[model samples]
Target chain A: MNKLVNQINDLLLQSIPSSPLETNLEESMRYSLEAGGKRIRPVLLIETLKMLSKSDNYEKGIQTALALEMVHTYSLIHDDLPAMDNDDYRRGKLTNHKVYGEWKALLAGDALLTKAFHLISTDGSIDAQTRIKLVELLSDASGHLGMIGGQTLDMESENQNISLETLQHIHKEKTGALLTFAIMAAVTIVQPSDDVSELLEDYSQHLGLIFQIKDDLLDVYGDEDKLGKPVGSDEKNHKNTYVTLLGQDKTEQKLDYHVKQAEKCLEKLREASYDTSQLEYLTQLFYQRDH
Target chain B: MNKLVNQINDLLLQSIPSSPLETNLEESMRYSLEAGGKRIRPVLLIETLKMLSKSDNYEKGIQTALALEMVHTYSLIHDDLPAMDNDDYRRGKLTNHKVYGEWKALLAGDALLTKAFHLISTDGSIDAQTRIKLVELLSDASGHLGMIGGQTLDMESENQNISLETLQHIHKEKTGALLTFAIMAAVTIVQPSDDVSELLEDYSQHLGLIFQIKDDLLDVYGDEDKLGKPVGSDEKNHKNTYVTLLGQDKTEQKLDYHVKQAEKCLEKLREASYDTSQLEYLTQLFYQRDH
Candidate 1:
């Protein structure tokens, strides 16, 4: 996993070359991308590809993985803008808007998002049909009906007493859509059997829930040093999170339930004669991460 | 042209379906899109396709045309954000941020941008290869090296004395790249010969310059009512426009030069046995528009 993370990091650095144009837009884009995260989405994409194909040659999936990371990073940059979440620090560094000023940061995020599709479209290794399919899936997952919709709901739900169902719906679109895209992109690449694909999708959904529930859990109880931001921001913002909807104990139970469900999906995949070890490890990482 | 505009308007209305999600994101996206503009970009695309292909069955180009309009509309929304131009009005109506609030407007722009690629990728009437090529071209034209890069330079050059070369470069990227994309996308769809494609590319660049130079001129001397905003706001913002750098007479000369150049390209296309009347009309429209 560490090796895969290093590989993803190296590729990201090379993703956006310094433009000869007289603008710091590229710099602003590179700044947020280089501010390291766990690379969880990309890693999941590559690992899913490798596990399903029974081959370590995951080279074909690299562009899609990088595209996924770019989308995630762009969202973070936009989310931290003053008009949005107004966050100053993310992952222990000044947010893109903090360092680049609001306007440039905003353009940088736009550029990064645009570049994600460009990367996939220009990946010469992939056939045109697959690339088109990836673009379709990605836009569906990240556009108005998916991540943006979830974000809209999340923003409106702030300071309001929201139901647990509403909270789940928000997370499902806001974050889960992208995570599911990560796994499904791999599935799209490998063309796995319908049963395997269905099982993998179910597993990804559970994983997305576990990931968000853990995020809510961490904000309340995890170490701020590890998380790289202050804890209890959810409460401070009056945001309704899983932890707020369901108390700490209940959140933990919910997290455990997802973890078990994820494992069950993996169990089905394993019985189908596919190696699920890498994905199993990923489930555990999402389940147990401190940040 | 009026007929084409109406067709584009009706399709834009149908482009974003109401999502089942509990959010007003689709409404926000549709608001700015439905807000009337000249629909110049998409019209250029469709007209270019018809001229090059000599086929009035432009149904093949409708989706791409709508996609082009979405990209244009998204840029306007983001450009009008409080963190950017901070504009209160566009097209005589409240800017997107003013209508939907800042965050939702931002997300709406993001969603519109993403949907552009989705529309192209899912365009089943076009071949997979053609769709992929369009995606590649659109992203390059609209991404970091193109539109976004131009915007960054424009923002940085505010209140500063900039060279003609620098100013032209800024407009070329900021406004010109996507305009070029408008024409070039049609060439891609029609699969024109190399010579014709080259000529069209030159024509589009000159057309782009004409568009921007006329924009500068309009901001200085045009009717505020026709423009749907106050004139001379560019000067108030301390922008280094063509009118500012070259003065009114020389700026008009520059616009005339590009108009002649664009006509020359169309003339060559005419000699090469392609109908150039539509393109000539577009060139005149760009050159003489009051707004």
Candidate 2:
């Protein structure tokens, strides 16, 4: 939505290693990392920091962005593994293991996931303590009580109809936790006022919920080419989704309501501190996107 | 060998989780982590920190010890995956996948590895920056230029005789890096004198080599019950080892030489502020242990 965000994304792609020893590893990581999904989490982080303070610690934000992407990509890579979702394709290409063979793909996922914290902690520009906090934020996001926990629930819920609360619990941890971290990381680094931090948390939580609901809706109705994976995948796997539980009309209404709530929270921030327009653009892009 | 070291080990065992959602994940982790290895790396770290300053930082050292063990255990979990070494057993129990199914086992390893950094960074007692440095030390030991790189090479060299130089390179990263990190973490946290830190590195490097050679020796001469895994598994896999490359006698001779070198370095620090005797005892144990 902004030149700064685009520049950060470009720098990220260039900075990640293209090593020979693990060519497939690098390729698979890059494939999904570069796949044209909205760089929302990273953008949210960088923008949140910008809104809170004007500083050159943007490098820390960039590292956080990249690290978040690594975690996201690794989850996608592993989620596509045979024993997991058993998906043959992702983003219109063969999944990592299918292309690289199971072993290297597995190692590549492991490598990317492990390397994420390394990237964040080892970046020289950030203060060491800040870097450590970033790692803490991320590790908590990805560990058992967070993304991994959400994934475990998701795996168990496949082919089985689950209650609304169980579904909410799964999506919140699986998808929302990292998004919350993305927002919180920036807030923590800037050491913003508690009210602003709390407001951002509310905004992030609403946006996160909207994100998953939109995803569920897309699986039911979005075009395959734009989505970059097969449509109806969740249904094929007998997976329960928000749309499955609430129906399309209710899901669409819910998405609209959450987007309004997110925007309402954004109104609490000082108008001079952030280009509220960028966030508005992002929220609109998120909820309205077909993919 | 000391009472304190034993107490630390007990704490480590008690701290690990055994929740029902990840029962086998916990058990698989405990399989290698709880298997009664020498616990040399963590003890070396604690002793090294104490040697630098007998301050109230032993708790930090204990947390670092647990973190390092988590990294070590994570490696073993992945290494034994079907895509990697595919071993059916580790220590005396079934390998991670054999016990928990492959996918969950893989996630268990990922969770354990990721949780390690969280444990250190969020320990609350240590400074965040110091925690960041500790993570850097760990990632450097375990990432591309470190343990994982070493593993990549080792996997590539399987069934093929590798040159001694290559083998040394492999062992340095694969085995020595973490050992070096164990020492370096303490040094970083305690801000040990340069002389002590450098000496500890020298001592740990040799200790690592001695440990590997002893591992090779075990494969050839160790008992299944004592070794906890089948002896000659390496030979069955047609993997080259120091015992095979240099002959059992030469390998033993080399182990003796490394142990002496380690002791010599320890001798240089005999009069340091903290105790070096525990480190010395650990080094001697490396060469003398049967398994």
Interface RMSD of each: 0.6, 2.2
Instruction: Give per-model TM-scores.
Output: 0.98, 0.93
Across B1-291, the per-residue lDDT of candidate 1 in tens digits comes to: 899999899999899988888578888888999996889999999999999889898977899999989998999999999899898988878998898899999999999999999999999899999999999999999999999999999899999999999998998999999999999999999988999999999998999899999999999999988888889989999999999999999998888898988988998899999988888898998888887
Error of 1 at A13 (Å): 1.5
lDDT of each: 0.92, 0.79
For residues A232-265, what per-residue lDDT tens digits would candidate 1 score against the true structure? Answer: 9899999998888889999999999999999999
| Candidate with best lDDT | 1
Q: Compute the lDDT of residue B255 as modeled in candidate 1.
A: 87
Fnat, model 2, is: 0.56
Model 2 ranges off by over 4 Å: A2-10, A18-36, A54-57, A270-273, B2-6, B13-36, B54-57, B271-274
| Candidate 1 chain B minimal-lDDT segment of 10 residues | B19-28
Docking class of 2: medium
Q: How far in Å is the alpha carbon of B277 misplaced in model 1?
A: 1.8
- Candidate 1 regions exceeding 4 Å error are none
